[model samples]
Target: MAEEQPFALQRHEKLMERLRLHGAVRVRELADALGVSELTIRRDIAALADRGLLTRVHGGATLPTVLDETPARRRRASAPAFTIGMVVPSLDFYWPQVVNGARSAAAAHGVHIQLRGSSYDQAEDRRQILRLVESGQVQGLLLAPSLEGPGVAELIDWIGGLSVPAVFVEREPPRWTPTPRPLEWVRSDHALGLELAVRHLHAFGHRRIGLVLSKGSPTSAHLAAGWHRACEELDLPDDFVVRESVALNVPGHREIIGGIVDRCRRDRITALVVHSDPDAISVAQYLTEQGASIPDDMALVSYDDEVAHLAHPALTAVRPPKTTVGRTAVDMMMARLLEGRNRPVQRTLVLPELVIRASSITSSWQRETPPAG
Candidate 1:
């Protein structure tokens, strides 16, 4: 489950989006759309009204600037200014929140988001992107293309020469010389997220820690870099990094996990920081079957927060700010459309948040707020 603060923030984002899209939002409609009670929506409206972000009407709330405007003017103001095409690999797991955030921001700004699902293949990425671009319906594009392939450079160049503005969401172009039109991107700083995990383990009195990065992931390289830097900074024992994955899908994963557990026992490694939640839980479950106690025998921290809270001991995790990245991608595209060539090329990195849980802490230890950086 999401925390109250993040949940309320998401509600406010949706509320403002509704207000912007329709110039006003009825309480009943908002309750249904947001899956909250009318009373909760009213409270939200009241809170927004106090902040002067919206004005409470008879049964709804209107944009702060729209309450006094004429009907015709309001309609003109609320009309969609742009339609953006988006292509992403999957609508499940990590990308759904991103799409939702982009949709919320698009609605809030009177922009439309037309999404297309594609398989995570370079060929499919090209097909989906070219289909949207050649259709000429979209004023801009928000794309998350497959970044690892022989033709990646060609793909980037093709996208760079497009007629409409394009923003890469959660993807970066591989190292290349500057084209006449450089691509812009917004992604989470996973490297720093890995550092957060190591620092948290260090503060929890772990001196000999291990890192297990997921194989065949774009994010693994970043996590490995972070692991190396954090180990150097913390002056912890080294030579314990495992780059390959032990996911259930891998053949002979039991042996792989057993070797990992045996290495920890030999090295006296008390804690581990893993790239993702599924892999972390696999290791944790294996350890449990071996009669090991979490935190007592082996504490664990996972990088992705997708299913961390669902773990048996409730894994501590680094939660990437995926929604914020999505919202920012749209906002950046809007700025590019408005500013045209005057806008500087941007490569923005948003930070991930660390959420502490039982797996990484002792019973007597209270959860401390994570560092802002």
Candidate 2:
């Protein structure tokens, strides 16, 4: 006879289908349907909850509420008594985790989050902000910007005029330009995290290290500065620094990795540090296809840790304290909402940790040599 399916997988499949069909399901009912104890069902639900897949209620679970897509003007005009707005470039993997943290914190304070995405378009970002502010829908904002091109200056100008209290997340305002008076920010220390990645490679005896950047953005600038700091600290020559910028898409990533490898070949770079896990995995695949073995011919490291472990050769990455950033951003926003908008401005900076994995190791060429007799 065939063996019974694993309890975890069985429960996950049933939970997903139930959530899709019924929008929510109680723990006891789910357990009875799957022929498992309620305790078993609770564990299954907890696993999903950890990933922000479903919301756990007192006795069961429910689907996350879909964000209202009403026009910003309309939303602002009929804004709730206490509503917070989250302005992000797009609702991708990164933003969602931050949003989850914000939502959880907001729920505790009896507040709601009005999340808006800009599709990485600066104009749209301005429009969304204006709608929220003019309609008076949001009392505060948690902004994670995508200041990619010429429009950033304009976007910043608009945000400065919004009057409501705001906190910038993920990316900080530019250095040369003075931000509109009294703008506050909460961000991961990209410089510190990237420095950690580079130092990890250097400790493994990799002198020639390459970097992949997302060009034309302030975020990339911080990452580049960190890479340079590491190289400078180690006294590596300028030629050892190979930088390549690519768009944030599958095709763009493919092209960027190809460019990185090309730079590696010309410069004899034996290691690479990327800005994100997705890019690290892409570069690893490209290197493997080109007959280079990981931790043998080259070493690799990256910034974000979420996708690292899932790669073929688990990646060594600098894990940002994303949950903390989320929690902090929400806390700041809530303070603005509760304590009146005139409260003293605050800034929170979160440091990330380095996680070592199989993808990065001492370069084979750097392995210890036997002592002579």
Candidate 3:
């Protein structure tokens, strides 16, 4: 037997369908058609109004005129009139949120996002960006650059010469090198996020902290800076910080965690902080498999709070204000398009906050017990 739909959802669905077909609908008519009371229809209208899906009129409801097109149409028209190329290192879990934020922000201003993944490979990324620029189809670009790419300076020069605005996300260009033209950029304050995570761990009495990072990215650089800053503020020695870089893949992650565990055993590290939630979860799970007790033998903290909830022991993570970063990027792009090119270069750095959870706690074990000779 088929399950019946809930009354509220059914009412909302019917009302939306009616509005879509007829462009507007009266409460009484909607109630009669859906076999619900007029009062029920009014409630439904109010709910939709609260969601900004529709506007409530004197006796009826109307479609939201602000919506440029139906959801279906919007997905199909992902790349609208002006193509905005989005270049990222990979389409991992975190990238999706950043991309979603960009897409939503672009939609508000009637722009579109055409996405391309680089898989952290510099050569392929440069080729893709050059192709898009040479094609003359893309008006602007939102790039997340790899830190260790070859010929990066040459590529940046090429991009600058394209005569289109570019916004770097999650990474910043080198400060030492001057660009022929100024570039607008937007990024999450990873340093701030790491500081928050480290502070939380320190508050829980974790002194010997280890960081797991991915190498060759500006994001990693900022995180490293924050980790160093926290250690300085806490009056801890540089030796208290241990770091290992790994590629961002399944097998790579396994090897990295194995290395981290080995380091923990050798260094007597009590607390660990990872750069991403997925990595933290993986490390925790791997530690459990090895018969190590969490929050007792070791404490864990990480960044990107979404996947934290899904971990076996919900992870303590730093949540970046990604939505704000997205919206700000759009605002910057709009200003570039509408205003003259000679305006001052704009940069927006969104701050992140630490969300404490079960994964990290006060360290119970004071020292690693050694085997008797």
lDDT of 2 at 336: 51
TM-score: which is higher, 1 or 3?
1
Looking at model 2, which ten-residue stretch has the lowest summed lDDT?
Answer: 68-77
Q: Which candidate achieves the best lDDT against the true structure?
A: 1
lDDT (Cα atoms) of all candidates against the true structure: 0.83, 0.72, 0.73
Candidate 1 segments whose C-alpha is farther than 4 A from its true place = 1-78, 363-373
Q: Against the hidden reference, what TM-scores do the models get?
A: 0.76, 0.69, 0.69
Q: Which residue runs of candidate 2 sit more than 4 Å off their true CA positions?
A: 1-81, 175-181, 216-218, 238-259, 340-342, 363-373
Tens digits of per-residue lDDT for model 3, 8-117: 65567667767777889998887788887899889778756654567778899887776533422333322343568888887876777888888987786567787888
Q: What is candidate 1's lDDT per residue for 226-265, written digit by digit as tens?
A: 8888889889766899976886677887899999999999
Best by TM-score: 1
Candidates sorted on lDDT, descending: 1, 3, 2
